[model samples]
Target chain A: MLLLQCPWCGDRSEEEFACGGEGDIVRPLVPEELDDRAWGDYVFMRRNEKGIHFERWRHAHGCGRWFNVARSTVTHEILASYQVGDDRPELPE
Target chain B: MSRARHEPLAHLALAAAGETTGPDAGVTLQAAPYQPAVILRGESGNAAFLEAFRAGMGFDLPLAANHVNSHAGATALWLGPSEWLVQSTTGQAEHGRLAAALTGHRHAIIDHGDGQQIIRVSGPRARDVLSKLCPLDLEGPDLAPGRCARSILARCSILLHPLPGGGYHIHVGRSFADYVWRLLADAGLEFGVAIGGAG
Candidate 1:
């Protein structure tokens, strides 16, 4: 059971949250505007970086806020966490 | 007020605090010092009632329904299948008006504004404190505020409200209030943090 820090709710058990996955991924603004290849690129493509990855998460149980996290894909080690609007967080090395 | 299944321990703690127990228990009260809370049970179509209540109370806090919706400012917690705990620090009198507004909507409203206590825990080691009591995964960005959930802390069920300021707003039943307080004090030992009551 991994205890997660809510930044807002202080710290809580992981049971209260829902993992969104590799943060900073944006969906195409208009599905119809893009060609099938471009849409596929947006939907199925990713850097798939190994060391540090940016992920999105939602507080499903507490304040209900959505935020981003920088974590290690290999070890699930969180390097850092930040809110969505926090100065345009960069991908950690 | 209505028993919510998502966090059984939390309601159980409320029962223990309210001294209303047993299997048939429905609504339980938890006291909040200085600040009073109103627990509302809305029947079908009570969403409108909630909106009306918010409007009637002059609530401009920009409520968010935790467990139901995750936004910010204020939010409602899903207590049971049909009940919710509309939490806000505004005022009880205003809450009373909100409750009164939902009177005949097939909902049971209880003023739980004084049966629980609110405490905040923050700093880097905040998550470590909760791990001592709860059994959930709290890694990545999953536990941020605007996110709320329920769990047991020190054998008492608690409602956790994430604060955007790198802290948590914890609500525990009044009976175990002191116990939780003591536990937090001990938990914050390494951080040399301070535990103070919320107004």
Candidate 2:
């Protein structure tokens, strides 16, 4: 099992949390102004990075706070976790 | 007709199931049923709320992760950045006092003590029993008093709070109380579990 860090509750077992796919998704300001292809890209497109990936997670069984986690899809190693609004942290080698 | 008191774990009859099992019972469990529990929600950064809370409960809300603060017999456990669980040490109503104290404030208080079960698990094998049910590492000084945490216990979410001397208070919701109790009993059987008063 993975050990995920919660910004409010510290490191806890992965079972206590639920991973939300992707992170930092933004909605287009004017949907009507966009063509069908542009809207589809904004709605469904995701950067499935194999290396350091930014994702969303919630400490569902613990603090119940939603935070962002930077993990590696290849290694399954969690790089770092930060609060929802905080800027994406610089990756550490 | 006088309203009959309902306990969360009365059906399991924990007292009958494990009483008089002997002093050598490596683990002892006690139930504090129908106690008043209050879930307090407010901005931690708001000075007014903090001041009012202290004036009402007698201490600052513990802001640290999984930290517990006890003052004047009431326990305030940190649940989230802006959420807390306020419970009385003596199985009484700390909710009443807190609700009255925080009146007119922009905050949320839910008196959810009705169906919650607060069980005390103590003795030499306390940690052993918990290790069976929970995923959190319960070792060393981390599980000491003034510490509490929320984690998965036997597939149920529980608030594990450590008491002053030893043992822990397993705060679980009504639906899973019986399930948790049975699981705890099953896990502690090898250690000679006893259900009794503060043993």
Highest DockQ scorer = 2
TM-score for all predictions? 0.50, 0.92
Expressed as tens digits, the lDDT of each residue in B1-199 for candidate 2 is 8899788778876666657566799988888756667899998888888899999888989988789988877878999999999877677788678877788788898887875788889999999999988998898555678888899898999999888888888989888888888898889999988887532
Quote the positional error of residue B182 for candidate 2 in Å.
0.8
DockQ of each: 0.12, 0.86
Query: For model 1, what TM-score does chain A reach?
Result: 0.79
What TM-scores does chain A show, candidate by candidate in order? 0.79, 0.92
Question: Candidate 1 DockQ score?
Answer: 0.12
- Residue B183 displacement (Å), model 1: 1.3
After TM-score superposition, the amount by which residue B95's alpha carbon in candidate 1 deviates from its true location, in angstroms, is 3.2
